[model samples]
Target: MRNFLYGAITSAAIATLTVSTLTVAPALSAERLSLSTWGSPAHYQVAEFVPMFKQLLEEKSDGDIRLKTFEGGEMVKQQFVATAVPQGTIDISLTTLDNWSGRVADVGILTTPLWDKSMEWTRDNLKPGNPVFDYFDAKLRDEGAIIIAMFDIGAPVVSTSFEITGPEAFANMPIRAYSKGSAQVLQTLGAAPTIMGVGDVYSGLQRGTVKGAMGGLGGAVGLKHYEVTSNMFVPNGVMGTLIHAYVMNKAKFEGMSPENQKILMEAAAEARDHMQQVAIDQLASLLDTVRENGNTVTIVEPGSPTWEAFAKQLEPLAREATQSYPQEVQDLIAAD
Candidate 1:
């Protein structure tokens, strides 16, 4: 009887320990952060950059932090992410500077015609310590978010039903513009600019509501714009590059432990750098896809006569658009 009682007590003690561990383990598990992105799952930033950031952050944090992502505007629309982050609708999100232009006009500097620089030049100049970045970051902070990383989608390209050899091709043409800056560019070229969502451009093209669309090559491939548009004008940097930033809610970011904050920023920077190269390679692949689809691809080399003339035509408009910014910002952006 004594031996049996001792065995029963040991079994009970073992069961209690197991139950305690199961309950306590969950309490010690990694803290989860929520991130929402407007890109579809197939988008490079969704498929590549976000995953890379998640892995790097988790590894760097030693599993102390985990991310939960909502892609394809599941939580907030692309245009609203800038506002949503500040309202704490999402802890983190990706936003284009142009989208923030309504709230912060200085961000429009990046979208101005004066910003016609190569991807390499952009990568070098639009980084953490740069004057442009500092100026924009301060503005964004006042609106309640912090920029962790900034990257380009690619050089801007335009797809049209008609052929485009030079700026004159845009004359009186109806083109879909994704933002006010893009609309301004199209208008300067004498085209009728209609601002629309990225998803709506495909249907708009099919319905003949718009004759051309301004965006990146990756967008052309992803949306299969080549099916409806016969010509793709790759003026490379003449139209300026599209910029997107990964941002975190200011309160959430500030509330984090300094160690975790450092990890998040480091991971974001690493992911941004890696994805910028991916964007370049992806653009090349996407161009091939456009060609394979039997579309004419026009390469307007930067500094060529046509590109130079296009730049000169846009110079006055660029000056007017940037007049609101500080002279230092205007000089810095306009500088070679």
Candidate 2:
């Protein structure tokens, strides 16, 4: 009887331990996600959006979800983030629509100077049910990534070693183009456009390989283009805006619980709104900084003669660029 009782006790203890281990295993296991972006730690997407996303997700998930972030091209370069996210190399990524343009031609519509809308206009129109947003979102989804949020980096500006007093200034000027749309714009303006990466632009300007570089004002300041270039032309709503989209791997996103997916979407929208306002404020301040640094900053007011002249010059190119897109998209641009 004593031996039988001892054996029974040992079996009970084993069962209890197994049950305890099973109960605690799930509690200890958390889903760790990796996010990558090309922006440096100082970039607004890094400084503002990333932390907001991490905090919201961790808190909402009750620590079940965690994020490992790579910034400043640590995991993948900016141009490759679109591919990396879908290929499962990255769980989430932030990249410009221009990077995805080669695969999804419809996205190139936004990169062109066709839309003379202000930042506010763009923001108001980029919501669900909006034809433009739905179109691009569907196109990206077909490519295996889902856009969680969209925000403007800033308005496109040209920083050159020489002053841009008039359209004539761009004649025969060699400038670095960040996208094919920008290249078309530059070429149409009689400027020689050289395709270049953002990282090489400062050096390109410094070495006189490119006399001017087309980019956002924030990028010019963040990358310290002021040190290498002398003038910045803010085309006010003339050159269109630079927009960045935050995306997630579609398979991973679909695999999440609906509640978690909702939480991610909410967090992304909050972060995007916060970043947009901060970007506006930062752009204004950075413009003042550029002026204070003894660099000439020119603003082409939307209705000014210079603006009208530029609008006229680029209208033909804009129409041509939108030819491949759907009629609804072309109408949207024409209406905008």
Candidate 3:
């Protein structure tokens, strides 16, 4: 009876082992992919994306393609993603156009209100027309790089946990601004626009340094800035986050098999689409959550004379900034 019981246990264990081995674990091929994001792992901007993308890519590739990820500024400095990925320091990443705006002024134009209205404009233009991507793709190659996907997932808005009831209420506070346009827009409203990155906004609030920062509702809710500042203003400001690119060092990209190249491009497209959907679908709901948490949402009236005056105050500067670009670039962006 004892021998029979032992044999029964052994048989069960062997059966489990066989089932596990038969499940087809992920296989790492010689080729690997690397990804980098702009901020710390705890920051919701990048964290919310990693799992979704990893699953999408790994599953799509059937585990033969491995993605090695680095978070924050470690993989590549926040400002160097565009230059570095093409130079082979990192394989891919969600690079901010504003970070290296100096190097790629045209790309920066896309991120600012100057180029597009929202993430939807970015996705739509690139999905089929791809005019913007084509324009910048030429520019990127000139800079020793290739941009596989360009989707503006960054939906920058103003959020302060307290009430920024109207334009006048925030006119004089030290608000953190990520882009030059966001800063200038705030300045036009009579606010002290301080330039800083998104990661710093939460800390800036904690230290009593910045009243608010211009970013998306996802960021405001995810970063817990709602805990400090309770007001979120809409149409006050919104910049479509320029995008993430599935960039590969030019030589490395060229080195891959045709099949692998196709997979990489497809993965990039999927990731870009995912980011756009998240930004568009979730932003209002995120704002709602912010309101539920005791914050207020106010939409600056676009047709009001006051709004017209406010826009007039800032329009010339926007026009002047665009003049430095190529003529065609200007013509393409000028409001028709």
Candidate 4:
């Protein structure tokens, strides 16, 4: 009886070890893909996104493909990720489209009020099919990049050294804005809008070149701008914008085995969902951090007379900026 028990124990141990080895094993063919993005290591997207992708990709590829990441300036300047990916200098880049607006005009459609509520709208309309992805997939494919997964960075809010309590306040300040919405939103408030790079915003604020800016919470913290200019004006008309992308070089993506490609896509789609949840959670934390640092937070009420008045004033620019997309896309979102 004792001998029988010993034999059973030995068998169970071997089975457990076999399973462990299989679970942790790497693929026979190992390939490392390098990814780059314009975010500093401290950037929320990078901190939350990079490791999640690496782990998911590794598990999906069953260890066959490993992602190597180069962040901050080493991979090329942060804003250059989209530009570099086309050249194949970097296999993939996590990017913000606002920076690439010059190259792809419709890309900014989401950045403006046209798609302000698009997070819910797009998911409601196009998740299973992802037509926007289809549209952009083709657009990006032509540039030698493929969009596999994406998420919103959270709505961008305008933070400033100056307070913009009313239209006049908004106007007198030649606001440094991010994408087309920034231009439209600030312009409606009666301010001159200048498209400014993320890196340039700090200097612009400090030197009084820009009295204020429209940006997100993470951006203000990451750039250390709160240290200089400390008021946050949160507007209801799309204070946030979506961000995050996991893309691959066209040639590299196509080179993957069909089975591996499917595996990668599945993982990426799941990651996209994870990213969206993270953004929503982080937004509150980011706001708390701003206040803890001694900055004032002003909530811009949605659909108030002030908001509607601003929108009415800037409707023309909004319409022109949103022309490339279906008018309904903007109207449904703008309607509220």
- For all predicted structures, in order, the TM-scores are 0.91, 0.89, 0.78, 0.80
Candidate 2 deviant stretches above 4 angstroms: 1-28, 332-336
Model 1 spans with C-alpha error above 4 angstroms:
1-29, 334-336
lDDT tens readout by residue for model 3, 109-186? 654446645566666666524555667777766766677766555546677645664557666888888666457667
Worst 10 residues of 1 by lDDT: 38-47
* Model 3 regions more than 4 Å off: 1-29, 40-49, 72-74, 111-113, 161-172, 236-247, 304-306, 333-336
Which candidate tops TM-score? Answer: 1
Candidate 2: residue 118 lDDT (0-100): 61
Could you give candidate 4's per-residue lDDT for residues 1-336 as a string of tens digits?
999999999999999999988876655357678988653476656777777778988887768878888876577564676778778888877777555556655566766556665445443343325556566567678778888776666666777876666566775677887665457656666788887767788888889888787776676778777777779876655334655466678988898889878877776676666655666667777778788888898776777776666566667666666666666445544554
Off by over 4 Å in 4: 1-28, 118-128, 184-188, 238-240, 322-336
Better of 3 and 4 by TM-score: 4
- What tens-digit string does per-residue lDDT give for candidate 1 at 65-134? 8899998778877778778999999999977778888888777777777666666665666778877677
Against the reference, the lDDT scores of all candidates come to 0.82, 0.81, 0.66, 0.69
Question: Evaluated with lDDT, which candidate comes out highest?
Answer: 1
Q: Which prediction has more favorable lDDT, 1 or 4? A: 1
